[model samples]
Target chain A: MNERQKSKLVVETCLLAGKIMIENGSEMVRVTDTIDRISHNAGATEARAYVTLTGIIMSATPDMGSQVTAIDKRTFDLEKVSTVNDYSRQFAAKKISLGEFYRCLKRMDKDVKPFPFWLQMIGAFMVSATLEIVFRSNYTDFWAAGFVGMIGWCIYCLTDHYTDIRFLNEFIAAICIGFMSILLIRAGIAKSADDLIIGGLMPLVPGVPITNAVRDTLSGNLVSGPSRGIEAIMSACALGFGVAMAIKILG
Target chain B: MVNVIIFSVCVYFATIGFGLLINLPRKALNMAGIVSLIGWLVFHTVNVHMGGYLSADILGTFTVGILSIFASRYKKMPVIIFNIPALVPLVPGGQAYQVMKCLAIGNYALAKSNLIQVIFIAGGIASGFLFAEFLNQLYLRFKTYIITKKATR
Candidate 1:
């Protein structure tokens, strides 16, 4: 390829790497740092990257000219993020060529696998059951939490597939969890639904987002910080509202 | 005590399952579990001594932050993989639930207190991480400065 073409390729590749990282839930500062590093090592004299929870914008000024690329796809997959980090570090160390790096990134994008549905359901049950133990609940609560939590997760998976609206999906998941908790209680499966419902909702809570929001604020990314903070609160509220709806309607 | 150990063990396994649900790598799942177990242990231990929820939250997260940095370096992986899942156990899940439960029941007073408590806990955890990161940055700068000074001499 010609020098100009290669520079353009580098910009595109860096943008792709940044996209993968951001979509896979990397921190905002880390996203910018990785993008700049990749572009700089790929022969860009000047590189700038701006990332938020929703999307990423990057520009690279190589000797040929300047190029900008933006992508708006966000998901949470840490395996992909880790792979991108490794690839960037290797590329910066001159251990990998641009073409090789590009190929690696494409493979990383496609290669990361989520746990199977059954496994995730089991995991959901385990999470809630153990949370009951931590909450000092009785054995009956533990069993009921497990059963209800798995049902809640099944509901979550179903809704998550049917809709791309995250808040709505979470709201529905909480409602399902609350409904199951109440059923368990009525069936004499458990004494109270409070701990069971809380435990069941544990998996859906936005723990990582809130933690990242605080970290972002402390690191001075004002826009991303408050935006993520609001996102966390909204998700929490959605889950709460769903549970409340279930209680109000069922009782 | 046995109670603390039991709580930590429960947290450890729960975190492992959480790691699985989040699709963390196998090695990372193990490390995240350990990191969270340690965080829970620290929180309980420090709470026993200090008798305050906020201080325990801070100390617990502070320990997790340091361990995550070390784990990231050792495992040749990003710190986020370890930190996020590990922070799960300590993430004020209980308080958040209480806020929602109270709000659902129309107990605005109880909901307000729960919301404030969640804010404080989240703040404490964040500050702990920030402090650890600050210290880590300082160490890196000091090491580089020493090396450069020696070279100049």
Candidate 2:
């Protein structure tokens, strides 16, 4: 490729790396660092990248112009982040050509595969049941928590698949958890609704966003820091509201 | 002692389950569990003897942060692959639930107190991670300085 085309490809590669990282729940500092590293390794002098929670803007020298990409969805998939980091390291060490690295990244992005649905449900079940025992120091509600948590997680995934409204899935899932835990308690399956509710909600909590917001803020990311913080708070409020609504209506 | 062991076991599995939920690399799953187990052990010990959940949380997350850094190096993966899942046990999910419960029952005073506690725990986790990162940076700089000095000599 000619000089202009090569530089444009480099910039495109950097933007793709940033988009994958951000969408997969990487911190702002890490996302920008990965973009800069990819461009720098690809022979882009004076390369700079500005990233926020919602978008990425990257530029090399003036002649190469700049590339901007908007991030639409965010989820938790550390495997992709780790894979991208590994590829960047390989590129830096001269183990892979820039074209090969770009092709691998593009292929990986297209072939994104999460764990099977049933397996993720089972994971939710395990987390809820065990976390209740860990936090409350009791196994009285173990099976109840597991069943309720699995159902809540299922509802969450289904709702997210059907609707594009932000936070609605979490709200509906929390309500399901609260109502199911209450019903289980009334049916004598669980002794305490508190344990079951907390456990069930574990799968839907905003743990990743909360952690990422704090990390971004501490790393001096002025834009993404507060934006992610607000995002976390909004989701938390939605979850809390759903639970509260369930309790006020039933309990 | 037996209670602590039980809590540790539960934490290990819980961390592993969360790791799976977030689709953490399979290679790092076991190490993430170990990291969270260590953090929970420290938190339990300090909370039982010292009677302060705030300090316990901060110390626990600090330990997790430091261990995750090492785990990432050993596994050749990003630190977050270990760090985020390992911090699962320390997150104040239970406390946040309490706040919602209190609000639902119309107990404003109790709800206010629980909300504050939740905020304090979150802040503690943030500070703990910050301290660990600061220490890591200092160590890296010191190592580079020693290497450069040796090369000059």
Best by lDDT: 2
Q: How much RMSD separates candidate 1 from the native structure? A: 1.8
> On residues A100-185, what C-alpha lDDT tens digit does candidate 1 reach at each position?
99888878746778888898888888888888778654566887888888888788878888887868888989989888888888
Per-candidate local distance difference test: 0.81, 0.88
lDDT by residue (tens digit), candidate 2, A33-111: 8887888788887888888888888878876667899999998898999899999999999999889888988898566
Clashes of each: 0, 0
Worst 10 residues of 2 chain B by lDDT: B79-88
Interface alpha-carbon RMSD, every candidate: 1.3, 1.0
Best candidate, DockQ: 2
DockQ for each model: 0.75, 0.82
Per-residue lDDT for B1-153 in model 1, tens only?
Answer: 777777777898899878777788777888888988898889878878879889999999999999999999999998878888888778787787788777777899999999999889988998899988998899899999999999999
Clashes of 1: 0
lDDT of 2 by residue, B63-149 (tens): 988998899889888887778877778888888988998989999899999999999999999999999999999999999999999
